[model samples]
Target chain A: MIVDLRRFLERRRPLWEELDRRLRAVEADPFARIGLDDIRRLHDLYEQVAADLADARELAVRTEVRDHLEALVARAYALVYALEETPARFRPLRWLAAELPQAVRRRARAGVTAAAAFGAGVLLGGAALLADPSARSHLMPFDHLQLHPAERVLAEERQMRAGGDLAGEQAGSFAAMLLVNNVRVSLLAAALGMTFGAGTLALLLYNGVVLGAVCVDFVVAGQTAFLAGWLLPHGSVEIPAILLGGQAGLVLASALLGDGDRRRRVDRLAAAGPDILSLLGGAAVLLVWAAGLEAFLSQYHEPILPYGLKIAIGLMQTAGLAAWLAFGGRWAGRPAP
Target chain B: MIHDGRWLEVETPEGVVFSLPLAGPVARFLAWQIDLAAIAAVATAIAYLTRWAWDLLPDTVAAVNYVAIFVVAAGYHMLLEWRWRGATIGKRALRLRVVDRRGLRLSPVQVVLRNLLRPVDQLPLFNLVGGVAMGLSRHAQRLGDLGANTVVVRVAPVPLPPVEHLTPPRYNSLRDRPHIEARLRRAVPPAAAVLAVRALLRRDEMDAAARVELFREMAAALRQWGALPPELTAGRSDEQIVRNVVDSYFRAPS
Candidate 1:
């Protein structure tokens, strides 16, 4: 049936083609205010012409009537789309676009809400892994790594801590690399997560799982409380930072799926303008932050700060992000580029 | 070259001017927050209700508790899609919807696909993988809607019917209703177009009743133009014909 409809339309292709040119001309005309009435008339006429086409085997083809119908439909559609798109030609976020703020605000609220719930789920998932010794094993494979390098890296890290060169540029350099690597990993976890949602889930799950497993691995390997002490220096901030980045990434995915304020919808990705940069920018910041934490602070270790202290910093970092977003009330009001 | 750099120019209901960029991380973040809070709250409640049911009934019957909770959760999701045509809590609070690519309601198959994929999309790692794909995809589809061939969009609680005034005067008479009723419907299609008609036509009735009568006429006018469903009521104030469809049907008196 659809093929037949196409063929029928094809028979009048010349007329519609002519009408299309004419319609395109009017489409940009400032006065073309296609309204619901126009669409109605066009739709009504379409049916009449379509019915006549169906009866072409019996009745003579009324090319003129078909042409008129085609023209009307094209005209109506053009007018409606034109009126809807024209104002946007000048200023972005025009007066009518002002509603976008409220809309965006509402969407932001929704994102926060989703983040909280997801966070809660993460906490619960964390608890679930902790409770199940076997499940904990699956999350962090490094936990059970009894490789000689584990001890070597552990010893090197310990030696670095005692060197007291913490104030040196080396420490800063180390921190930077750690931050960069960490951010990249988180981003990798997020960016490479483009493998459909499964990869993202795997990235997130494996991360949590690895944390759980590695934590258990450390504790079981006679690191005792010292094992706890080891991760505290950076894992606290690093882990949660990665988690936060993932939250942003996930939110992007869900919204990408369609949180439709026509102007703010995911369609904007392909839509032409500076807005696409802004859209990608939001995600970029997450990657950058994740990277910074991984590079600069992930390696911080002083007997002065225990696992508990580092963990506190991590928790604080996460909390700070929540507070910032809650108070910021517009995606952190980043300075315009 | 004709298009702007990034976002495509779009015409918002109030006529805002900006390229319509796809909802990104920031926008998505906000949308999820609003959606999950309600879903979690409801899911928790359903769990509690079923938990209570478990205690009241026999083990075999109590086993039904799990099924009961599932039903409520699934049913809530389904019914809202069926009725409001969006996620229940999100739709009511934020006035959004899940629509086909063409902005029509989802088919039953689409609904099932969206809901079924929920468990997967909600998997650990923040649906990170799913999100990137959604962002990159041409349709901006998440895993659920990707499977379902649907996308959730912010819907005006009442999407107004297209009312264009650019074309030549070519108004058609009504086919749904005949005689004086069709005439009245044509005269005041939006119900709010004429205050005098609303006030003077039936002055003494309750506001609701009078509004009902007003919309009935409007609905008839809408019928004349074309087969306009309630979807047109989106994002508009004068959407009574769509909002109170069953009542408007009776009120039309044609």
Candidate 2:
């Protein structure tokens, strides 16, 4: 116990001040490279100040003094014993080739679940359209989709033949709109995972219903080639990107449920956090590519860009994407046995 | 970790415990409002700065502007909180900080996840969902905070109480009776002693009559505990007696 508060403060004040100064310096520049000696010094100061806090809590000093020491110690502790890795310089190529695919493969079960949800919606939508044909209005919300697929295909081809620019000078703006809208939807799907995947599943199902209904509408109207040429270029990437978003949501939900895991809920969530981010980041990148293709290439019809060539391009992209995700990071860290 | 109403008491691996004050929903809401205004201000500034570009290549400028605004809106909190160690512009303004629930360093994924989940917390407008969640949560966590394993804390500075002003008189009657001084120190709890010292430090802020009554009650308590002789306390005022007792208790024995 402190017999003389003034004397104790006088003696310990310098160490506290030093710790405070060092903490401020570190906090001021998060990316600064601290030398080994400096890191050791910081650790030492933290222990000393933490000891002081314990002593102060023994009622040796006023509450304010104890509080000050506690604050100082807390700040130091966060820095000294941080659990997360230090921020490293980002390398996009390495991330694309390795981290992105690895993250997806880690949560393959969730991706399958997401695909199942979308597939169920597709089946239901297709069945409903085939049974009633009037459900198209409800399934397809867009005004353009309301047009008879064959008529729309004819109009699109005629416009191309007449040299009428479908997107014209507004292609850039349209691409930007698509990028913004798709990313927002993907993020929403991921965020709604907090509701135990209900909202996420519903969003995926709705998107699938629209896709299924539109495809059926075109095929029934003898516009299968037009549909494939128009959608495959962008949809190959964009659809998968949305499915990735759904995958992220399912991953978040599984983490929350912790079905068989024994770790605490927060720990599970923390563990899943990085993978979710990677999934979302990967989705955003794919959406960017999809948006550009959709706005510039997918809008054109047969006379401008042959359906066969477009189909070939789309098939090649799908094959490449499948191969990459399947084997992108398989040998990243294998030992030379 | 223990959540005792307003404070989160965290025990470190070394067995040292510290408490962090939790920020109330009202303060958090105000901080969010400030952040919204900041976003709006940035959007407006971008519009003005890009006005010249709008006239040059209207389509390209519009496209760039759309993407830029969307990025700013989406990235503002995530980027700032990541860089500032869980403080956005508004959080810094209000002296609030987002901290890991376990008092560890804030992680990048935590920052991204929390911001991404803001949309769910903001369901049906005006953060009704987040507000209700905060009110019901033991640690005042919204859905985003829960998902991220984070909590917002108040980091207001604690000013040291001025003990020097409670200097004992040259001829202190309490010091003359060292046994009674010892008794007072032993009887009085540390918290009570601190409260008495704090009262003296902020005596100027209290109302005149209230201050008098406060000191009277304090002095009576001290006297009862100290059991000083009548002659020793005969002519001393309540404030003076309280000050004398504190000084005697806190001062080192000569």
Candidate 3:
């Protein structure tokens, strides 16, 4: 059948133009709703355009004409069929109450593995430090270790109790500093999980080893009580947060290792997406709280409180964190009817 | 045409087949370059501000500045990609944006995964891994895009060819027999139809002899598809008959 090109263009142009204009409007405001009538008209116009696009397959359509029609059809198809995402209200609160614990539970295997790796590092590091006192300088920077050979333990404890001359600005900066540092380490553990998760394991091990080495110093110095007073204030929360980050990374690696075609693997990876987000977000929040405590309470209160009182407060803080993570959002998980 | 990738055909649940023209690596590379420069600029500005803050603060805070820099780098891509419909500043400048393979808006997790794996895509140096992946992949996806089930596509430039008037004829004899018309449509290849349409539109610019010769060739070739009804072709010239065929194929009957 002989089809007239000019007649086809002349007859179909208005429909294409109308569809194009409406699509642009829709694109501009993805959430905007035109009247029901306009929507129906737009849908009808889209069907007609879709038919024209298919029919254009037979006609000697110009490249420009085909391209124009193709773009129009694609846009219309997306608008008509694309699922809309409902805006999430109170996302952080929702995440904390419902998603966090669920994600933690889902990634428990990875979390256990992470904790084991960290514990091994601590064991190895403490052994290494106990065997050689000189190892402390190498394990941490000299400035960070700050172990004055000439100073007596009592003098150092007094100085620590006094706390650094942290002015208001310095205190604020100290909090920011700790928050950033903790978050960075956590993210690195998680992000590097893309490396088949080996990097995550290595990072966890390194952090644990350093911590173990630091603990050895307190033991050798006969200041285990002081160490607990300083670390327990925040370490209870901070350590778990870091372990969760490592777990998040391991989940990514597992997703990558999933057996399938690339599409199936991507689908698998997407399935793990919520867990990763929840873990990372929860860790970030915990790190912030840890940073605040490390800045204000840990450094300042260590000297004044009796060792017994410090231990009690530390146990309470740990218990509070445990209870919250285990049971924060009881009602949020139920599906709305 | 130089960097054109072939169409990717997908069948919808409703059985409609749609084709997306896959973007080529060259355009993707150019877009990446634009993004790289934009990111670098942002990093530099953040670095300057953070450095000033560090100088005033205690030495303990100095190390944290590096963490801030890392956050800026990672957050820049994730936040913009998720919130801005998958276009970063550079992607916007290059008129390229990331889209889900199924033509849906990108979810937050997809954005995070894609951006997080960017370091993997940049493995070694200068996007070697990403570029190679794009070259080899069917959809020209880098590892990050592949992992995230996303593809970057060129935004169609607008305003699409000016609207033209639709003048449906009072009667189209060919439309009466749907079976014959369908066979005819199936017979004529889309590329050939496009050539014929192009020729007809530019016929005025063609030499009279060439135009006549072109129309005769097209009309002769088109006849092989099926016999045309005499009612539609009784008094038409070969050129007129070709135009009728093209129009009949494009326009649907009421």
Ranking by DockQ: 2, 3, 1
Tell me each candidate's RMSD, in Å, in order.
22.2, 3.1, 6.2
At residue A115, candidate 1 shows an lDDT of 40
**DockQ of all predictions against the true structure, Cα-based:** 0.01, 0.55, 0.26
By TM-score, the better pick of 1 and 2 is: 2
Name the regions of candidate 3 deviating beyond 4 angstroms.
A1-5, A29-42, A62-64, A83-90, A131-138, A141-143, A146-163, A167-169, A259-263, A301-311, A330-337, B6-9, B22-72, B119-136, B158-194, B199-254
lDDT of 2 by residue, B1-254 (tens): 22235777788888899888899988899999999999999999988898998877888888888999999999999999888888988999998999889777788888899999999999989999898889999889999999999999887766454546566654678887888888988988877787787788778779999999999999898888888788988988998888888788888988
**Candidate 1 local lDDT, B1-254, one digit each (tens):** 02112232232232222222233444455556766676667767766756655544434233344344444554566666644444456554654456555433455445543554454465567766457657776656676665555665442222111112111132222224344343444443343433322232233344886666765565565544435544444434333332333223213243
* Model 1 CAPRI rating: incorrect
Span of 10 residues, lowest total lDDT, candidate 1 chain A: A269-278
- Please provide, for model 2 over A144-255, each residue's C-alpha lDDT reduced to its tens digit, 9 standing for 90 to 100: 8998998898999998999978466788899999999999999998998998899999999999888888888898898999999999999999989999999999999999
Model 1: residues >4 Å from true position, as ranges?
A1-19, A22-137, A142-153, A158-207, A219-284, A299-316, A330-337, B1-100, B103-254
Q: Report the C-alpha displacement of residue A128, candidate 1, in angstroms.
A: 7.7
* Interface C-alpha root-mean-square deviation of candidate 3: 4.6
Correct interface contacts retained, every candidate: 0.00, 0.69, 0.31
Comparing 1 and 3 on TM-score, the stronger one: 3
For model 1, the local distance difference test gives: 0.44
**TM-score, per-candidate, Cα-based:** 0.33, 0.92, 0.76
